[model samples]
Target: MTQSIFDKFQYYANLREDVARLDTNPFNVVVEQVLSETEAIVNGRRTILAGTNNYLGLTFDPRCIAAGRKALEEEGTGTTGSRMANGTYAGHLALERELADFFGLPSSIVFSTGYIANLGILSTIPGPSDVVLLDADSHASIYDGCRLGSAEVIRFRHNDPGDLDKRLKRLGTKAESALIVVEGIYSMIGDQAPLQEIVEVKRRHGAYLLVDEAHSLGVLGEHGRGLVEQAGVQEDVDFIVGTFSKSLGAIGGFCVSKWKELENVRYAMRPYIFTASSSPSIIASTRVALHILREQGAELRKRLWDNAHRLYLGLRELDFKLGPESSPVVAITLGESKEQALEIWHDLLDKGVYVNLVMPPASPGAGCLLRCSLSSAHSAVQIDAIIDAFRSLRNNILES
Candidate 1:
């Protein structure tokens, strides 16, 4: 008997059954269906959304829509080619320039997606002789990028600068050729990296630093430049990477640096060279979104924080184990039992509220999480409704 390639997928095929027993299934998003906004028909009931990461709420912005429409009309649908080929249009160049200006960096390179941005930059910048030190809680993209580089990949304790320093010291002279990567805010735990301490450690070790501002760009810093600016270590960071999918409310990614040599990587990077360039509409809308993010991010950030505080305080008061205690992203810890988490998740959905159910590897300590991502556009009433759903679930669980 021969093993089949389909056998590998058998585990996932039974994931629903496993998830049902635990009561926590992170991959399913089938509750509510809607075009936009929080209100959605979920399981045939109108539900309010809390799972989405539309942080800035620019996805439905009229200006973004208009810009995208204009580009679609002028440039057709797709670029249909790689950037190094015939895909580099005037709009692409303009967007890159705009992004460079937005970050106050001399050079910027845009990628088709945020994942590609990390992959391109990390894989191209480092080689076999180099080392990539990353936060254990870093995103999958960062890990994938390091793997693509064929470099010595090392992980430190999540958000632990001391651990990072110990690892760097262990490397000894090789630390000089290392690249330390950290996220502005870890996605799952909703906790921030101790960037100042990490930067200090990197500086002492004489290693380059790459800060992926995927979640923090347009949600942190003075003009939403990111955590590098938030930590006041803009000059210390060698490369700053960000995504448009979060606060920018678009779909793309970019890497910005003062180094002119970064431009050369455009040729060498397979991720950058082989991937189809971003569409004209995406570039146009992203450029406009970037402008809006830079200008109005402060005000929007205030509202997002306000909503986050309300939800966090509400959940904490309701006796839910919360992560970090402070951050725009709030996770309601539902203990280690996946079953309890899934029950609560289903109950929340049934009560007309939707939130992300995280479990296992995605959640820290093999814990389960009801992740709530806040946006400035969410009204206080909407947040209150979400809290009410959690409260209902808690009451039901206690009674049962």
Candidate 2:
């Protein structure tokens, strides 16, 4: 019998069935209402939101809402066209310029979403003659971008600059032109990259580097420019890619660089050219959020880190196996038992705490992960509630 193309997903279909049998689905969590940045209504219960990556908690900022409302009234609801066509609204151009200025870069290109920003730049920048060296634990979009491009793709050990150096050395002469890709803060475990060391290795090998600051943008650096600024390697790095969704609390992505050539890449990028640009309201709100971040980001960053440290220490006190360090993204390592992971995840939800339940392939190691992303807007009480929820699951986690 001829095999159906859908046969490939049979295993996932079985997994879904098993989850349904448990009477809970962590994957399709629906928020009935967002009461605040840190609280939401889920499954008809008031739950503390610990998964949404609203790092700076600007999602409901009055200024951002006002900006969006004004744009919605003046510019209509949608752009309805790609930027290369008719979607380059005045707000879009202004946002791009502001982003470029924020990064102190010569050029910038905005994308409809963070995923496509990676796709557009990664797929277009590396030619057939070049090589793409990336971290083994890179986000799916990063891997997909490399796959879409014509360049040969290679993986180095995660967060190991020494491994990257050795790999680049093996390339010999080609190392000079190879494109190295890594993230400022890894999304899964929330550990930061050793960017200063990575920069040294890149310089020694004469290679270019791209740091995806998706999670780290508002969480690091005195100026909140991300790991690049924190590491003080701005001059050494070639490209900086980031998303506005997390810190800026809007839906968009951007790539900024000192190189003037990125302007030319914009025209050649199919994802950027073909996809409809962000709506006027999103752009307007994003611009206002960016402005807010610039003006009042330090306080927000302090609050975010304080909350992260609090939760991290609280979980640690309970003897929970967590990610390596204190970060806004705190992941509890659960042994290889999807059932136990699901049970604990369901329990957390029952206790009015909602986090991300990560299964294998998506998770880094040979285990499941209960990932919690904290935000600046999360108050002390909310952070403690998140901790208490996990503390209540001690027996389940200990068993695993």
Candidate 3:
């Protein structure tokens, strides 16, 4: 008997059937209308968007809109070619320069999305002779990138610098030239990596370091440069990969480096070579959004942190299991019970709030996660309303 290729999806198909029987689907949520930065019409009802990773909430910013509109009108829709071809618009080069300037780095490469940035760099930089050491709980993009490369890949315990040191020691001479990858702030649990400690481990091992600041950009540091600037280890970090989708409220990713040799990697990266470049509108809006993040980021960070703390503290008072620290991403851990998690997630949405529902394989552990990412644009009343919704759940089903 031969196995069908469709046999692989049986488990997921069964899981989908189970969710469908519940009369609600967490994965198929549709926004009927985007009411504001914090509110949207979903399931034919007004819903508070607590799950969106819009850290700085510049999606509705007039300045960004105007810039995008101007670019759309003048440059038309898209570049319609790869960066090495007709896609390399004036805006693309200008944005790359601006990004390098923002990070105080010498060179930068822009990709269409954050996932591609990781894929292009991770797959291209480390060769067959090199080794890639990453956190065990890294995002799927990181894992896929390593698989795409010829380098030997190893996983260290998540955020465990000691484990990283041990692995590097085991590699002997190869450790010196290895690449160590970690995120500034992990997406799942909203916990930040101990960059100062990780940097020390990298230095001790003589390895190159790459920090993905996708979730931390515009959320950390005095100037919102992410954990690198906050830990004062910018000079030690070899590469800083980040996305404009979060804080900048645009769809693009970039990798900025102090080493001039990164400029040479552009030619070797297949992901960069084959993929179409970002549209002029995206680059223009991203540039304007980056400017906003630089100039007015302090106030925005304060508000964002305030909302994060407010949500964290409120959930803690209700005795719900949460991530270790209070950050923009607040995850409520529901132990290994998909049914209960699904119930709670559906309830929250029905109560006029929408959050991310993460399950096993995707979540960090055996548990499921009801992750809520707060936005700077969310008002105090909106925060309280979200809390109130959770409180109602605890009272109605959780506590009982």
Best by TM-score: 2
Q: Is candidate 2 or candidate 3 better by TM-score?
A: 2
Ranking by TM-score: 2, 3, 1
Query: What do the candidate models score in CA lDDT, each in turn?
Result: 0.85, 0.94, 0.93
Residue 357 error, candidate 3, Å:
0.2
Off by over 4 Å in 1: 19-26, 30-35, 395-400
> Per-residue lDDT for 5 in model 1?
83
Candidate 2 lDDT by residue in tens digits, 1-400: 9999999999899889879966568988889999998898998999999999999999999999999999999999999999999999988999989999999999999999999999999999999999999999999989998888899999999999999999999999999999999999999999999999999999999999999999999889999999999999999989999998999999889999989999999999998998999999999999999999899999999999999999999999999888889999999999999988999999999999999999999999999999999999999999998988888899899888
- Among these predictions, the greatest lDDT belongs to 2
Looking at candidate 3, what is the lDDT of residue 111?
96
Candidate 2: lDDT over CA atoms? 0.94
Order candidates by lDDT, high to low: 2, 3, 1
How many angstroms is residue 57 displaced in model 3 relative to the true structure, after the best TM-score fit? 0.5
